[model samples]
Target: NYLWINHGWMGKKVKYKEEKFKITAIDGGWSKWSPWSICGKDCTHTKTRTCDEPAPSYGGRHCSGKDTIVTNCTGGLCEN
Candidate 1:
């Protein structure tokens, strides 16, 4: 409990605590995509990339659509 008086004027005193925090924003970077995988069942090929190039850090944004990608290859007929 406290009070402040200035020029015969009285006012209630307020208490406050100060806080400090640091935040660094980093955008994700991607590495080169690996070579296409050999055709597998259904003649499908897969390729993938990683964020290790500069992986997201300290609440940084992740690379958009960083998921694995599967593509169809020619002459890859699935044999029952």
Candidate 2:
């Protein structure tokens, strides 16, 4: 199967890989990495996680890289 990065905030949707994954979102400059949520509706300025690795136990395992992962700008954006 073919897969490509899907950007929901940009309304860019495409067919995804068959493998299971978890999607997350970050601001524009943070695209290459993950942003930490300092609080509800707020995020920390310190950049810790990168797109190349899983997030630090935010709760459970989340998709980090191209492992069938898609990036979205909202929590309810991607279907999985």
Candidate 3:
């Protein structure tokens, strides 16, 4: 919880530098990634995650980076 109190000044204008209250920005967060799709046919698989874990709001920036990844599999070297 945050507490803020302002005193005095019934008819006065305060500059930005004089203001004591501040608004903090929030950053976005991502949820756990889904299991990689069974590497099949094309020997390729995919995994994904979303930013809904903590969707950006209140002037916050959206999560950066890709939400999905595609990986290529190989013989005798398939992902465990």
Candidate 4:
């Protein structure tokens, strides 16, 4: 649940400053309302998925085979 304290959707491109937010949990799968995942470099692995297993970059919960999970796609690889 996010609180849009101040609405900046209509602002100009230069006025916009992107902020990093983490996806605490997933609601089954990534539909339109999938929470943003941005928890440092360490991603919280689900119970079914082992810690040794690498998380997929752009994949849903029921993903199979080798997947690529980009950890910091939201705010870039390095924090500025």
Candidate 5:
């Protein structure tokens, strides 16, 4: 029950009686990745890394594993 509207003197109507909020659940954030992209044909390469964070609202708790991760690069043997 909440209704508040007052504009100068042309509209005045206020009646509110609702106060009970207990929402808590948000645990998901990540932002630390962006330095592994430049290996797509050297000798068996494959690198990747990315993370922009921001993912968890109103009862959120996810994003704890991987945003983008790939490994396996040598670039030192390929020419036969």
Candidate 6:
């Protein structure tokens, strides 16, 4: 028996006897960061937040970068 499959609008016909396929899930992504923790007594402290995205699945692209980030705390008393 023969089977014909249309490749696309191009009207190309393809013949196949049998085909194999594999599927995989993507990597997981970082979840939303918790509230910023209290900064140190010093004004020169750091604050951070995180992403809350789900991880990728089924051989999908994995989350590449960091989940959390930190920034200088310039509004604290220490700054004075």
Per-model TM-score, in order, reads: 0.59, 0.15, 0.56, 0.16, 0.32, 0.39
Regions more than 4 Å wrong, model 5: 1-15, 27-36, 40-54, 57-62, 74-80
Model 4 residue 45 CA deviation in Å:
12
Q: Ranking by TM-score, best first?
A: 1, 3, 6, 5, 4, 2
Clashes of each: 0, 0, 0, 4, 0, 20
Q: Which runs of model 1 end up more than 4 angstroms from their true locations?
A: 1-23, 75-80
Show model 4 residue runs off by greater than 4 Å.
1-34, 39-63, 74-78
Provide the overall lDDT of each model, using Cα atoms, as 2-decimal numbers: 0.74, 0.42, 0.77, 0.37, 0.62, 0.60
User: Candidate 2: where are CA atoms >4 Å away?
Assistant: 1-6, 20-80
Q: Lowest lDDT 10-mer window, candidate 2?
A: 38-47
Q: For this target, which candidate reaches the highest lDDT against the unseen true structure? A: 3
- After the best TM-score superposition of candidate 5, give how far the Cα of residue 2 lies from its true spot, in angstroms: 12
Best by TM-score: 1
Off by over 4 Å in 3: 1-24, 74-80
Estimate candidate 4's alpha-carbon lDDT, on a 0 to 1 scale.
Answer: 0.37
Worst 10 residues of 6 by lDDT: 43-52
lDDT of 4 by residue, 1-80 (tens): 33344447955334344678875532232222224444443433211222223333333254343333443343433343
Residue lDDT tens for model 6, 23-61: 756566666556665554564444343332665666667
Candidate 5 lDDT over residue span 11-60, tens digit each:
76766777989987776677766676655555444433332256677777
Worst 10 residues of 3 by lDDT: 10-19
In model 5, what lDDT does residue 37 have? Answer: 64
The lDDT, on a scale of 0 to 1, for candidate 3 is 0.77
Model 4 TM-score, 2 decimals: 0.16
RMSD per model, one decimal: 9.0, 22.5, 9.3, 21.7, 6.5, 8.2
